[model samples]
Target: MTVMAKPRPTGQPGYSETLPRAAESAAVARRLVRTALAAWGLEDQIDDAVVVITELVSNAVDHGRLTSIRVVVSRPTEDWVRLAVVDRSMAVPLMRTDTNDDRIRGRGLLLVDRLTERWGTDRYRWGKQVWADLRCESAR
Candidate 1:
């Protein structure tokens, strides 16, 4: 089961969760995005958000040392929904410069860059937040 945050019609607010990096953080991210969308009555933006969430969680696990992954979701504005993930690593993440070669791994941020309208990072108490903004509407 996934955790659900209560509706707060005010300033910025988010939920945080920690799970082992070995655990299925992607699925939790998916669930968080869906719940956030539904809470805002914007289920139409579901698919796009899920893809972005998956990528974010995957990166957190790959680069982070601690098995714990943290996800934060917020509505920064009426036009965008923000998704963020934190982990227990200090190394910053960068968009993949190399192309997706053979059977190796990578391209998480690359996919995020292409999908999200805007994305950035911020330092947290433990590590950092790699987050992206999803447009509120499909046509946008």
Candidate 2:
């Protein structure tokens, strides 16, 4: 796995890391986000960001069936932080509502919907990238 962090500019702090798809990749992704948030002095947004990263990375690993994944965390504007997970799958994720209450899975995107300002996917030549934008009140 390779991790790269960019210097923080006036309004932008960004980093991208690539990791082999594994059960532990989700935790690594969370740690990367936490470290970036700390460097950017955006600790106040850690919890929500971690949750969003976990869901996105988990989906990439569990459903995308990818061999590797790239995670990007960036602050496009002072008040918004975007987390994106890229994988070698072109399939877009769907918000599953057909799952029964008795089942204990398939609710990752539901949590993401409630937590992010907006989320979507982008198709690339190799695969797809799923991303979420979280509003950071303390960033400004």
Candidate 3:
């Protein structure tokens, strides 16, 4: 389920929704990203943003060890939109280069790395937030 909450009061274009930590959450995350980018006039970013969010959400759902996760979409600047998945795990994500054609897993982060301007994790007392930034080419 997608929660319709107001943007935070920080004067930034941001939207967040809490979702159950399951594989299906990725679909909800994608929709949230599409809506946010379209509203911000960054429709060009929807495709990549969807992939990034799906990987982030999948990682969280599979490895976060929590009951629920939060998806955050924010326009940090006119030329950049940030997508993040917050979960109750402090384990940092590692990119693996050992996956061969036989392996169907472990390539998610690689896709994220190639598609985003930058991506990283922010550790908090309660959990961690993995985020990726997509540059709004049309804004430049």
lDDT of each: 0.79, 0.87, 0.89
lDDT of 2 at 22: 79
Best-matching candidate per TM-score: 3
Name the candidate, 2 or 3, with the larger TM-score value.
3
lDDT of 3 by residue, 1-140 (tens): 99898765431658899999999999999999998887777787889999999999999998887799999999877678889999999899998888667888878999999999899999999889999988888755
Instruction: Give TM per candidate.
Output: 0.82, 0.86, 0.88
Question: Where in model 3 is the C-alpha error above 4 Å?
Answer: 1-11
lDDT by residue (1-140, candidate 2, tens digit) is 88888655643547889988876999999999999888777888899999999999999988676689999998888788889999998788999987667777789999999988999999988789999998886743
Give the per-residue lDDT digits (tens) of candidate 1, residues 29-112.
Answer: 788888878877779888888898888888888888886888887887788888888877777888778784773668778778
Pairs clashing within candidate 1: 21-67
Candidate topping lDDT: 3
Error of 3 at 105 (Å): 1.1
